[model samples]
Target: ELKVEQNPLFLSMQEGKNYTIYCNYSTTSDRLYWYRQDPGKSLESLFVLLSNGAVKQEGRLMASLDTKARLSTLHITAAVHDLSATYFCAVGGLTGGGNKLTFGTGTQLKVEL
Candidate 1:
């Protein structure tokens, strides 16, 4: 089986709310990343965590990585309708090519207006 997993396959939240999506991996990896996708659209890069305790944020979304724990987190702050989309976390080794990505099943986020 793939090494990555995500919780809450589907989630619905009201506008201006906060929530968090968790990602867990089964093996050691050099990096963890988060991505966002809209219906019928391609994935957009959200975060790239290279080391443990690495945290990055943009707009209402924040992502953190812990290599030792083999986990990642994406936190949403004050979500808006525009934030309604699917989120995915991918893991890979540092030396491996992009082809090494193991993507999670994805979490669907719906924000009511």
Candidate 2:
């Protein structure tokens, strides 16, 4: 069975702070993805790491994947109130035709003034 776990299920961050979220998986997977969702909003794709040593970043968030260790990381830099939202990491496995993804419980981030 493949499972994904994220630490710090809830985070309270002040404006202009930095934090990192960790994700660990139970089995081998073909891809890893990071997404952000604001209250009452759909998920927004942040990064997709396909293989080992894959790293991608946008704005104030960075994501990296390690296929061998079955781990992924999302680092937030200089977070703002706008960045306050729930973050999730998902792992995808190769199925017959389409890929199946298993998501983490999610980490809610609150950026205070």
Candidate 3:
């Protein structure tokens, strides 16, 4: 079975600060995905890391995956108020039926001025 967990379930920081969110999985995974969700909105895909050294960035957010260690990270640079949201990391594995995704406990980020 595959299980995913994230640290610092809630984060509160000031604008312009930098922080990194971690995701750890119990078993090997084929892909890692990062997502963001606002208080009352649907999830938005942020990054997809397929390989061990895969890294992707958008704006102030950067994501990386290490398949060997079954770990993924999401780094926020110069966090802004708009970045306040719930973040999640998901691990995808091949299942008997199809691909299965296991999501981590969400990290609620609150960026204040």
* Highest lDDT model number: 3
Clashing pairs in 3: none
Name the candidate, 1 or 3, with the larger TM-score value. 3
The parts of candidate 1 lying over 4 Å away from their true place are 94-99
Estimate the TM-score for candidate 3.
0.96
Off by over 4 Å in 3: none
Comparison by lDDT, 1 against 3, better one:
3
The stretch of ten residues in a row with the least summed lDDT in candidate 3 is: 93-102
After superposition, the stretches of candidate 2 with alpha carbons farther than 4 Å from their true spots are none
lDDT by residue (1-113, candidate 3, tens digit) is 77899988999999999999999999977599999999999999999888999999999999999899999999999999999999999999887997678899999999998
Whole-model lDDT per candidate: 0.90, 0.91, 0.93
Candidate 1 similarity to native, TM-score: 0.92
Report the Cα lDDT for residue 37, model 2: 93
Worst 10 residues of 1 by lDDT: 92-101
Q: Over the full model, what C-alpha lDDT does candidate 1 score relative to the true structure?
A: 0.90
Q: In model 1, what lDDT does residue 24 have?
A: 95
Tens-digit lDDT track of model 2 for 1-113: 88799988999988888999999999988599999999999999889899899999888989999888888999999988888899999999888998888999999999998
